[model samples]
Target: MSQLVIQDLHVSIGDKPVVKSVSLTIKQGEVHAVMGPNGTGKSTLAKAIAGHPDYTITQGDVLLDGRSLLAMEPDERARAGLFLAFQYPSEIPGVSIANFIRAALQARLGESAELDATGYYKKLYEKMDLLKIDRKFTSRSVNDGFSGGEKKRCEILQLAMLDPKFALMDETDSGLDIDALRVVADGVNKLRTGQLGILLITHYQRLLNYIVPDFVHVMHEGHIVRSGDKSLALELEAKGYAWLKKELVHA
Candidate 1:
């Protein structure tokens, strides 16, 4: 089974440490929510794991199915089945969404192998239909001039097409209206299965109401201070982070 194991991870931006010895394990088919206030290093952890150069891993190891990912480059890590859905997806002007995803998939193929264009479009259309994205969207530039909801939905579309074993989704619901949030949630829900593991990072419990994670982790000051099932999310939602801060101080 595929699993993502982060052990004693310490990450930094330049010389300033952001993640302090945070560790977690996510198994295939599980949805693990990482909740924390801004600057608590939730996004930092996800970016570090995805091999973002800005966040340096000062100490620790990230492993995927027993293989150490710390040594791999960002592209290498991606090809190894690790995917990060950004909080702010970049705008790639002049590049069609279909071409962008096609390039990514092509990069993963063997040198002598070729992607069947007809087959590729067939699969892309199926995934687009499933996500409720218009078939005409394939020709649009990636995230260019897209609405906040449309951008988020575009990321989900990429996720669906890539079929990564493990996905780190960072604040996917940000800037989305209720309708857009539901659409994105539906796309994510449809992709959930025993073969994929997802680490969902968000601040709001409202998203949890839709995605329904298997586990919830509360992070504070770069460490996971609390963990529980879905109820924990509700508790945190009602009580807010103040109680969690107090508990951490008392502990």
Candidate 2:
């Protein structure tokens, strides 16, 4: 099994410190939820690990399968099996979903290696069916004028097609209604059975209710403060971040 180790990571954006000394390890086939209120640096952690240019890793390291990710470019990090599902997926006009995903898969292959077109379509249809997406969706432009639900489901479709070793999903539930959230969560749940460790980031427990995590971590003021099982998420939903703040003060 592969592992993604984030060792005492400290991130800064334009010299403003965001994530501080955060450490965690995600092994394949596990879902770890990192939950906290907005502006707590949850997204920063994911962006930093994904090699986003705006965020700098001032301290520590992120390793994929025991290799440091700090030196790799965002695209290189992606090819190395680190997938970062964005909170807001970008809209690409004139690119069909089928072509876009096919291009990504093609990039992963060596120059001399040819992608088997028939096999690719076969697998794509299988995954789309598993997610309950309409086969006709293949012809739509990527997230161009899509509803919130459609955009998120498209992100999941990309995830399924890419099949990375580990994924960092930042606020995937943002702007989603109950029905859309359920559909997106269902897509994620279906993909959890392989070498696909996921670090699911969200601010609310409602998302967790649909997609139960093996571990739940709480981030506060740029660092991880608490971690436990799915029950911790329920506690957070009940008492809220203010209560956790007070408890931290007492502790």
Candidate 3:
């Protein structure tokens, strides 16, 4: 099984340090959730692992299946089987959804490799159907006029199409209503398999209600302060992060 390992990671943006000495590991078939209040660097951790240029890794190493990912570019990381679903997906006004995803698939091929358009569309249609997305969506501009729910579903469609070994989802439930949340959550649940691992980052515990992560980690000031089973999430939901802060203070 493939493995993603983060070791003593410290990340900074320009002069400000956001993530401080964080470490975690995700093996295929596991779903790990990272929850924290605002400004805790949860999103920063996700972006840094995905190799966003704005976030610098001052110390520590990120590895995939025993290979170092620190030197690779963002595209390189994707090709190595890492996927990051953004909180806000960009609007590609001129690009059709089919063309965008097809181009991404094409990049994963060898220099001389050719993509089979017929088979590609067949698989694409299947994934769209599985996610309950209409077939006409492929003709529309990527997320250009999509509703918040549609946008999140589009991200899930990309995740299904790309079939990455590990996925880092950043605040995927943001701005989604109950129905949208359930649809997105169901799509995610269907996508989870022995071949894929996921790191879900969010500020609230509601997302966990749908996805039910295998492990729950609490992040504070760039460090994962506490970790436990699904019950920890409920506990955190019952009592706010203030409870954890108080516990930490008294210890």
How would the candidate models be sorted by TM-score, starting from the highest? 1, 3, 2
Misplaced by over 4 Å in model 3 are none
Runs in model 2 lying further than 4 Å from the true structure = none
Per-residue lDDT over 37-107 for candidate 1, one digit per residue giving the tens place of the 0 to 100 score = 99999999999999998989999999999999998999999999988999999999999999999999999
Worst 10 residues of 3 by lDDT: 187-196
| Residue 48 alpha-carbon offset, candidate 2, angstroms | 0.9
For model 1, what is the error of residue 247's alpha carbon versus the real structure, in angstroms, after optimal superposition? 1.2
TM-score of each: 0.99, 0.98, 0.98
Model 3, residue 18: distance off in Å is 0.6
Total colliding residue pairs, candidate 2: 0
Error of 1 at 38 (Å): 0.8
Q: Write the per-residue lDDT of candidate 2 for residues 1-251, one digit (tens) a residue.
A: 89999999999999899999999999999999999988999999999999999998999999888899999999999999999999999999999999999999999996888889999999999999999999999899999999988999999999999989999999999999999999999999999896699999999999998889999999999989999999999999999999999999999
lDDT of 3 by residue, 1-251 (tens): 79999999999999899999999999998999999899999999999999999999999999999999999999999999999998999999999999999999999996799899999999999998898889988899999989999999999999999999999999999999999999999999999877899999999999999999999999998899999999999999999999999998998
- In candidate 2, residue 135 scores what lDDT? 95
Cα-based lDDT for every prediction: 0.94, 0.95, 0.95
Query: Candidate 3 — what's its lDDT?
Result: 0.95
